[model samples]
Target: MEASENWLVESLRLYQDFHAFDLSGATRVLEWIGDKGVFVAGYESLKKNEILHLILPLRLSVKENQGLIPDRDFKVCHGGFSDKPVFDLKHVPETRLLVTSGLPCCSLKVWQITEDSDVIKAVSTLAVPEEGNLWPRLAVFSSMAPGVLHGARLSTLRITDLESQKTAYTSGIGDSEVLSSLQVLGTDTFAFCCTSGRLGLVDIRQKWTPSENISPSPGSGGGRWCADIRNGGQGLGPSIASFCSNGQLCLLDPRDLCHPVSSVQCPVSMPSPDPELLRVTWAPVLDNCLAISGFDGTVQVYDVTCWSGVGSQVEPLFTHRGHIFLDANELDTTPLVTTHIWHPCKPRTLLSAANDASLHVWDWVDLHASS
Candidate 1:
């Protein structure tokens, strides 16, 4: 029995070493694109090396970084019932589903995926009134807090209860413009960013009017347009930050609930006069850095400090070529990068997807350590 136990321990050690070697030896790229935009959510299962990606194909395939996901080979939803998948969710490991916003008529669609058949099972179909176009954003806050998902349009931001499968709350937001980004900041509070350079705070628990019209700087030509609010590493108040249209990164202090506490301008020179930073994501483990993808086909890493102060001390740390284009006018040249995402688990790894149909991954190197 002693000898058998010893052999088992040695075999497990050998297996660990083999897995590590295999993970570092080669690189694999997973691509998913269809008529809908590519929006990906990841799940970590109990099985070792099990990677599952819920890919929503927008106009282009949105590919996720492999480093962020553990298991490599997974499912790719092609069709079945729904024409376009607009929303997807992967909050837990065991049970995962994809939700889509119905086209034309305006409805909510859900799907349960099975590996054995490689077919997406239509779970539930919910409906919404045809008010405007649906822009869906789903977020899982706390394990026990239930789930709150939202979608945007030109006129309003609608919230849906995932557990109840009903519209719990709706905010009549956005003047004549469209909302670009929405984020959950607190237990029931969500921050909505618009294309016309405005930020609104909605407390779903309250029926009163929400707080809106938050501009980062006076006469700064409104915010860059589309903005995403991210919690600083601390996961506390004043942790909120935004990436603007003008390539500026600013911090939003929900504690004050009035104005931004600090802001940081990007160091990279704009490729053109009308430059839009497509996506800004926080580095998972690196607290002092933020990753940005812009319209110039460049992925940049910035050193950030005092995220909620007058302005974050921003410094260009690294830059890599990206694949996306900012707009149609710059198509003759390299298109500007439109989206960037950091690996949820890997601190130094990033993925940038652009209109160029080219997805690139960046691995940040420690300059001092290498030297």
Candidate 2:
């Protein structure tokens, strides 16, 4: 069993490496644009600037075994000092737009690639609150209105219209909990997870009112750190994948959020060690599979096809350990996984970034074949 696990981990081919900046902090955001490009966001504490990199994989022939290389002239953007900046990209068939917040002397900026030029250009800047943390926990483009963007402020969720450069709607989730993440469900509805271990469903068409609230446990404080809505498939309606600070992954049905359809505990050491979940994203091709990054420097893929109810533990399909541990204790780690993202078009490709200023592009086709 141990030998097979080692082989599976070793079969991950290092396709590319992206280390252009002198960034020391862990990457806070990573997004892939189809199979050709990726966007990485990180903060440099010494320089007090946020770094955004747009990397394109070099086109090579099949006979070339030198590995995938980044373009010689990759694009880089620098923002202001922020612990976590809200960064996301919107890709359509014809247009590609990138939205980011928490820049120095700038609240929100929208960038897009022009048809004539490959360079990214600023298109608009949205309004933001004057006080509180400038970093937004969530920033997502609305599915219904392509020009509209929804982002979370300190305690409120604001929707901005990119075309008009105006605030469309703003609502607060009260003072009890902080908004952790947001996932758009459909045209008019979206779901948000909170630090209070609560899940909320909001309908923008209904005057931005929260229609439902589901509290999984009283005082769980393991707040659902991240939530992602799956792309429907396999006779299943839209469901949610949520990861809590206490290392709990729960699958909840949108219709009945009061109880989770399935729940699983993440692998962690004993003595009540709090494992921080950095990111959670569903596989672009596989409907029943999802990947999660942990603060302990591990990335795990879980298959939820058999997940049916609470108290049922779901084992990870595969575990990838790219970051290294410096000391004997797990608490003292060399580098941690800050962000990880699966390829938008390729099911076997994944990209991960760590605080050690390293980026790895992993191809897991061989591992899947072996399994």
Candidate 3:
């Protein structure tokens, strides 16, 4: 609630279950495998000029020290591209679990991890075609189409059927501003935002034209570093939570992108370096709960329902400070949080990694009870 030092101090609570492990290098990307208690991550290479990737399974229960499980950790190959990879996972149908990732080398790949096995392995599927010589910057599976995959090549959006591997629709997204994030609002409907905080909604059923993007108003030129769309349910329509490079949190409705539902100044420290690196993620189990990170050592979880668009900024519900300590040995030091994510099923749980090769997973206390 109140934006006061006391509320901030009160929100600082100890970890209910803190488990951490350190690697030899920093982690660059992290994605969860649905609600399977498993996640995929990319990290720096211990080997020279090489990178290491992992698909590891982890449970939430923690007491003392916890490390990676043997034989369950699988290494993923980068497929010859040094650039960052964009990947997403689908874990339903329990029997068949798979992940889709955009390779830096102009390809979209699907990897399946088998169930009912003692040892886990990553099986590769056919790669997405390299159309227009554009590297597949992002790839995500469509909710309504089982074999259909929706992807983007920089500012161009491409929807294809994986079973046939044929493109269904292609269109340019907003004057080629370099889309930073894409979210599926419906099977053929979706939203995208550029690095400059320009948001647009596109429906594949309709022909995409310049008119699809509403002309942005003046003084609205800012980078929407990253964004997440909360699915339309729980008595609320689909909504977008975008964090800007200029230190503002914008809430947008998919039906209308030209006007923000609301805007609030974010919690960025003064003169911060590289604000574009910041990211925003919505909790799968909490409709109004979202987490924002990349500003510093800690990841802040805020309740948007409490934010006042006209009043002062609202304090975060819970502040995860585990990475600031860098584990038990290191204290009072803040590390750059490479990435943080909400548990697919656990409402208040979080998994975060730091640039120092440290991973911390904690389930913060319930907000209502703690507050």
lDDT: which candidate is best?
Answer: 2
Per-candidate clashes come to 23, 1, 4
For candidate 3, give the lDDT of residue 225: 60
Tens-digit lDDT track of model 1 for 1-371: 46545644544432211111011111112212322222342211222221223342121123442333333322244333334422233332234555544234366555666666645566776565565544444443433424545555535456666567766676664545555566666667777766556767777787736676544454346545555555542255545556665666666565554576676667656632343335666676776667766646667777666444554446667665423222223357665554566656556666564544444444556564457
How far residue 16's Cα lies from its native spot in candidate 3, in Å, is: 2.4
What RMSD does each model have against the real structure? 12.5, 5.5, 6.5
TM-scores of all models? 0.64, 0.75, 0.73
**C-alpha local distance difference test of each model:** 0.50, 0.58, 0.57
Top model by TM-score, which number? 2
- Rank ordering of all candidates by TM-score, starting from the highest: 2, 3, 1
- lDDT tens per residue, model 3, 138-249: 4355454544434443335677655566677777544455566666566566666666666666667788742223443233354446677776722344367777655577
Look at candidate 1 and tell me the lDDT of residue 79.
31
> Is candidate 1 or 3 superior in lDDT?
3
Native-to-model Cα distance after best TM-score fit, residue 124 in candidate 3, in Å = 5.9
Instruction: Identify the superior model by TM-score, candidate 2 or candidate 3.
Output: 2
